[model samples]
Structure formats: structure tokens, C-alpha cells
Target: MKSITLFLCLFTYFSASAQESCMTVENIKALDAQWEEKNLNPDPEFFKRVLADDFVWVHNHASMIDTKTSTVKRAEKQAANEGSDTRSRIQSEVKVAITGNTAIVTGFTIVDRGPTPTRYHFMRTYVEVNGTCFLTGNHTMAIPEGE
Candidate 1:
């Protein structure tokens, strides 16, 4: 009877731990904002911290694809040029979903850096490992003018 009781207690504890490990929407939203900030500012350290080693990003209707290394390199290059980036981004219609240790965030963003505003629909995937969240995948599609 004591062995059975011990097994039950262990099972319950593990179950609760699993539930606690799942990422919440609020958590993912905050993380998503960090991603947007990275885009706006192109900070290499922030990208390094949030992006997984094998992260992949499909940018703007497959115009280009970038890996974690490439993304960091691009940020470094951008950072080298002083006062070049003047982009401002606004995110809307954002939604987040989570399954166990993984989260998916979808949103629309309008960026004003050129003569006119460019809009995009984007999705980001994040995974929690050892209680830390890392961006694993990203895909974005540009919305054409007037629609």
C-alpha cells in the first residue's frame, strides 16, 4: 500500500510539473514583442538570446530565407551602419496559441520606413527548453497595396 501511495504522489507531481511548463498566451505575447523590437532595432545580442541555434525565417512571401547565423550577421551588419534604420512597426490582430512546450504567434504589422507603409502578416514559433523560451521558426508574407 505504501508503494502504491508513493507512485501516486510521484505521478501527480510530474503531471503538475508538465502543466506548469506550458507557455501561456501572455508569456508568448511578451516574447513576440521582443521579436518585433529585434526587427525594429536589429540588436544582435537580443537575437542571439531569443533565437534557437537552428532557427529559420521565411521572409515576405519567400523573397528570402534566413537562418539564425545569417540573421545575426545581418543584424551585425545593420548595427555597423549608424543611423540607417528609421523603421517603426505597429503590430495588430495578434493571437497566440500554445501546445505543451511550444507556442505559435500570428499577427499583422505595418512598418513605416520608406515613402509608404508596408504591411505584413507574420507567424512565429517558440519552444520552451529548460524554462527558457527560444524562437524556433518564423514566416512572413507581405500584404500588397490597397488590400
Candidate 2:
């Protein structure tokens, strides 16, 4: 009886952990929405919760690289200078793809800060770690003005 009870307990624990590790499209979409919201309105807690400690972001075709610490600092700075610029952005054509414990999200965004809007293409990579998802990597490319 003791042996059977221990086996059942182990099985139940593993099952729960497996379920928690599974990533769905809806989950990715929700996370993506949170990322977008943070971008528009900087949230330090959101960044801390979602980004991995070693997270790295490459921007504008590698013109800039940011680590998790740098990102948080930049967001803090942006939050401080909030009223100086009227910048807002909208994301579109977003798609999520999952493979094993990793997910890749790609999208296009248009930022309106002035009379002319600038467009960008972005990709974010998320990895499941101990039943939680964290943004591990990010890349962004600017779309040329015309085509």
C-alpha cells in the first residue's frame, strides 16, 4: 500500500508539472500583449517578471544591443521623460510558433512619434524554464521609408 501511494503521488506531481510547461498560442498572444503594453507604457515590474536574467535584445539590425539590466534602465529613463515625446506604436501581422519548450513570435509595428510614422519588424523568443516562460531573446529591424 505504501509503495502504491508513493507511485501515485509521483505520477500526479509529474503530470501537473508537464501541464504547466506546455505553451499554447493563446498564452503566447497574451504574453505578447503584455510586452506591447510595457513598450507603450514602461513597467519595470513587467520587465522583471517576463524577461530572463540573461535576456538580450538586438535593435535596428544589430545597431544596438541591450541586456535585461539595460532594458530596465532605458524603460525607467523613458518613463521619466514621458512628456517630452508623443510616441505611440501599434503591432500587426503577429505570429507565434512553438517548438518543444521554445516559442518564436514575429510581428510588424508602426510607431507614430511625429508627422511620419516609422515601421519595424520584430522577433521575440521565449523559453519555458521550470514551468514558467521567459523572454530570452529579441531582434528588431527598421523598415526603410519607402518600400
Candidate 3:
């Protein structure tokens, strides 16, 4: 029937459009890099854009999880530090997974943790809000010293 044919066409069109709207690897990387750059430069406003109200972060070296408020306050305080070593990181093996409006970014990063450099594998999850990605979870594992 014409009704059945029209239904099929509509379904196909919608399905294809939905698939096209899903996040791509380059899009994920660009959005994530924006947040990273803001953080590296120590901007408190970065938290406003990239974090949800319920954001939480698990520090690799900390015994406690950080809440959005706590993390923002800490970054604000750190922004005032003068003459301190500027931190840098080298990232690799990055991967992104998207599910509906949620995305998970996983990667390995080499950071100067102390007097020596260290590698860590990290996972961060985000949800798209108003077409902008907002981080909701974070975890990182340090790679072994020799490996």
C-alpha cells in the first residue's frame, strides 16, 4: 500500500539522519582538546563549559574523589600559582566511543608526574548538553614504571 511504502521511506530517512548525527572521532578529539587547552591554561571558566553540575573526577594519585565544586575551586586556586613548573602531557593510543548522547574517551598519556615522567591510561566520559559535551566521569591508571 502507499501508506506502507511511505512509512518505510520515512523510517529510512530518520534512521540515516540519526546515524549521521552521531559523534565522529575528529569531533570528539576537537571538543576534548578545547577543554584540555582551557584547563592547561588554568581557566576556571573551562569548568563551566565542560562539566555538568554533577561532574566527578577520580585523581590518579588521590585518596578521594573530586566533586565539581571542589575541582573548580582547586583549579581557581591553582590559577594563581606563580613561577611554578608548567605541566605538559603527551597523549597516545586515544580512542572514543559514543552511545546516544554519551561518549567515553580513553587514552594513554605521558606526564611529568614528579622528577620523572610517567605514563597513565585514562578514561573520561561525557554527555552532550545543548550540543556541547560535558564531562561527567574521569579515571586514570598509572602504567608500570618499567613498561
Candidate 4:
């Protein structure tokens, strides 16, 4: 009876942990969707809630930007682009690996806009700080054709 109880306890703990990990992945996925819909729509409050203060974003073009200021700047730049006026859709296949309070998410995003389509493979690392999940770093690479 004691062994059975111990097994049940361990199973419950692991099951709860697994659920939490899944929730974290879903949160990150939702954030990606929010970013895709309108980068400008993410407020500073949201950034504070989701991104680490020292977050570094590495763009596919090899430009590196700080998350805090760059979040707004990126939105502004996107707004200025002619492509902003066109409707674009992004689909991502995200795989998240969680270790303690930190998580790494790697995925490929395919974006379609009118007659053009682009694909980006990206990896983002996130950490839980002060009881909130924050994006710490990111790297993106463009996938060549025929891969």
C-alpha cells in the first residue's frame, strides 16, 4: 500500500509538471500569433510581461536588437513597409524544451503574403524571472530553397 501511494504521488507530480510545460508552450505559441497579427499591437506592458529586460533579438538579416526598444521599433518599421498594407499569414511549427525555469523553443515559420512567401527557421530561449516568463534571446536563419 505504501509503495502504491508513493507511485501515485510521483505520477501526479509528473503529470502536473507536464501540464505546466504544455501551458508554457501554448503561451509562447499564442505570443507568436499575436506578433504575427500586428507587431504594433503588443504594448510595452505586454513586453514587460513576456520579455526579459536584457532580451536580444537576432533578425534573419543578421541585425541584433534589444527587445525592449526593438519591439516598438520593429513595429514601426513594419508599419512603414509597403507589405504592411497587405494581409499576411504566418504559420509556425514550434518545439519547446523546458529545463527548470528556462525553455528553448525552435521552430520554422512560413509566411504568405499575396504572391510572395517567405520561410524563417528560428530558435528562441526564454526564462522565467520574477514569476513571469520572459524571452531572453533569439536567433533566426532563412531556409534555402529545396531543403
TM-score of each: 0.82, 0.83, 0.75, 0.64
Q: Please, what is the whole-model Cα lDDT of each candidate in the order they appear?
A: 0.88, 0.87, 0.76, 0.67
- Estimate candidate 1's alpha-carbon lDDT, on a 0 to 1 scale: 0.88
Which whole-number lDDT from 0 to 100 does residue 115 have in model 4?
70
lDDT of 2 at 61: 71
Question: Model 2, range 22-110, lDDT digits (tens) per residue?
Answer: 37788987898788778888877788889999999999978999999998887888788782253787899999999998999999988
TM-score of 4: 0.64
**Once model 4 is optimally superposed onto the true structure by TM-score, how far is the C-alpha of residue 49 displaced, in angstroms?**
3.8
Location of the lowest summed lDDT over 10 successive residues in candidate 2? 80-89
Q: Give the distance in Å from residue 35's predicted Cα in candidate 3 to where it truly belongs.
A: 3.5
Q: Is candidate 3 or candidate 4 better by TM-score?
A: 3
How much does each candidate deviate from the true structure in C-alpha RMSD?
4.4, 2.9, 5.7, 7.1
Clashes of each: 0, 0, 0, 0
Model 3 vs. true fold: TM: 0.75
lDDT preference between candidates 2 and 4, better one? 2
